[model samples]
Target: MTANEMTGGEALAHMLLAHEAGPIFGMGGFQLLPFYDAARRLGLQHHLINDERCGAFAADAYAKVTGRVGLCDATLGPGATNLVTALVESLNAGIPIVALVGNTHRLHSWKNMTQESRQVEILRPAVKEIIRIDHIERIPELIRRAFVVATTGRPGPVVVDIPEDIAHATYPFDETWFEVDSTYTAAPALRTRPAAENLAAAVELLVEAERPIMLCGGGVHISGAAQMITRFAEAINMPVAHTMSGKGSIACTSALNAGIFGRYDRIANRLIDESDVLLVVGCKLGEIATKRYTLPEPGKKIIHLDIVAEEIGRTVIPSVSLWSDAREGIADLLEVLPQDELKERLAKWAATVATRMQQWRVDVAPRLTSAEVPINMARLLHELNLNLP
Candidate 1:
């Protein structure tokens, strides 16, 4: 082997490092030993896991927190299968993750090879895409494609299957070939904005609405638009409600906060029912968010904004659909809003929300201090909240 030549495992590690993908999680096995060894030599961070499922979950959490494409790995058959549950979670939650799986040698596959089951078929439904690298020369390109698929447009997990033979094959290295597209390294890679006409239409509805609310979903957090959404809601004095996954889209202490709606929620459901116009951002208004698809009630005008256009009307049809990245859409809405006028018009509503929140706090106050035998969950939660640093 010459300096210009690199093994498939080395190519995979080099490309991942070039893309700054790190803190990988997985339990290594014989089929992936070369890749693991290359990862170690290349100083790529790897957190050893007892199970592949745990690694996938760790990756999911990492993506949720950092807005980056999380990376994980697995060996053949059972190891690959173990990632299904976590992959499905990432798919549904729209978190970006790139999973690398080892495979039996291509020559030995289906010849009664150990740990050889149709892994690709098993993982197809669990991920956005499953890519198998049949040729060693394509390792860098395929790995690059995996990241692109995982992080782009609605973000989800992508699996890159590397047969043992492919992992060990050698190919000439070209630094330029290993260079990664910077765009696909993180979630919401494109940050697309809605059309000017659509944004204008949404603004018109919000301006005209007598009782307007903003409902945020996990997309706010995923797009790193929490701060933008918070600022927009506060500026217009719009009462903001959220689904469970959108908990931190705004500060819990914000005066405009209406809390979570739907099952296992706070005081937002009633507000949603009464609102004349609902501005939903980043949320799909799924079953849990809509209380089995019944909240928001019929006859209410809705302005829906999201990265995925298809989801805009999948549940509750939006009167005005703004298809864009959460942050970009919120920024545009703020840009077009008649701030001074909106604040003045919404003052009464804001006051009402404040009053309602005060009464809610009062209603739940006793539960926070309850010292009953086993102790109420609310009281325990309050205690924990007070004690946590």
Candidate 2:
């Protein structure tokens, strides 16, 4: 292939390789042969899976594990449709993936094509964007845009359909088209810190409360603020309870760990009910986490910290809302706190929560033996606690 006369297939393969694409998972057919040949020439490793659906799933798994755009390919019609289920999963799970599908040639396009339908329209709803390439020259631009859309705000999948005629057509490789600016990074706006007066009011509530519990959520993991959470909890000696996804936000083995808070454990439910104050950090207070917002009595105070202000007071109205990065908010609160008083209160609360947890375990122990298989809640909790940090 001459430098200025590279085939569309070669250009597509080069662009994907430029992005450092690895082991593309997909099923192959005659329509996609040119693209596969190009990939082989470019030394881009191909992961040939048994079915197109599995290929899409493997691609989703790859993206989730590597934090990069996953790649999958399929031939026209049925092959493309087979990937729909896995593509939907990737979309819901917020994974970045690229689906490349082959299409009938331009000359044969409208003549009752055997393996051709409106592939782009069918996939439009399930992906970030869809680019149907009828011309060879548009391949580079389309590929670049696909990556941009797939990995951006609330990342999901994108689709690129290459007509067989276009794939075989020759075009000059445009190096500049694939060069993305290094400094362009996706950074969502962090939440702003609470005002001094608001902070003071929240602190007052915590200081006066006989039982105060700290609840952590997925945002802690997303913000990489687990250590900050641990620091804040330790500084106050407060009992730490995590939502299922936030299990590792604080070391589960820590003496201050009060176990998961939600419908999962009776002790957790009791702790939420009895606590005078709740410090909700990075948790959205979603229905799954709060059991449809069946919270404690109306008089209890709640201090909620989250990156998005709307998430605060979502399920239950919070007494104080700190719209800020969870890590930064916790750090700021620690700075302004009466450390001695907070520590004393935390120690007392931890002891109380721990005792309640032990009693809960004892109470649930009998329920396990009621069944022939035994519903081992304690064992499950133990296993979960062991797996968590």
What is the lDDT for 35 in model 2?
84
Q: Residue-wise lDDT of candidate 2 within 1-389, one digit each (tens)?
A: 33456778778887887777877999987776878998998799898999999999999888766666789999988888888999998775556788999888879887888877877778888876788887788887788777877765445788898888888878776566655532211211223566788788788888787788888886675455789889888888888888887888889667778777776755676778878899998787777678766765576789988866766776788898887777777888888888788787567667776677677668866654344345467566656765897
Worst 10 residues of 2 by lDDT: 182-191
- TM-score, prediction 1: 0.97
lDDT of 1 by residue, 1-389 (tens): 23468788888899899889858999998887778889989899999999999999999999988889899999999999999999999999999999999999989889988889999999999999999999988888898898888888899999999999988888888777888888888988878999999988998998898889999999998898989988898888899989889988999888888889888666788888888999999999999999998887887899999998999899898899998999999998898899989989998987777789899989999999998979899999999999998
Residue pairs that clash (backbone atoms under 3 angstroms), model 2: none
Per-residue error at 236 for model 1, in Å?
1.1
Q: All models: lDDT?
A: 0.90, 0.77
Q: Against the true structure, what is each candidate's TM-score?
A: 0.97, 0.73
Worst 10 residues of 1 by lDDT: 1-10
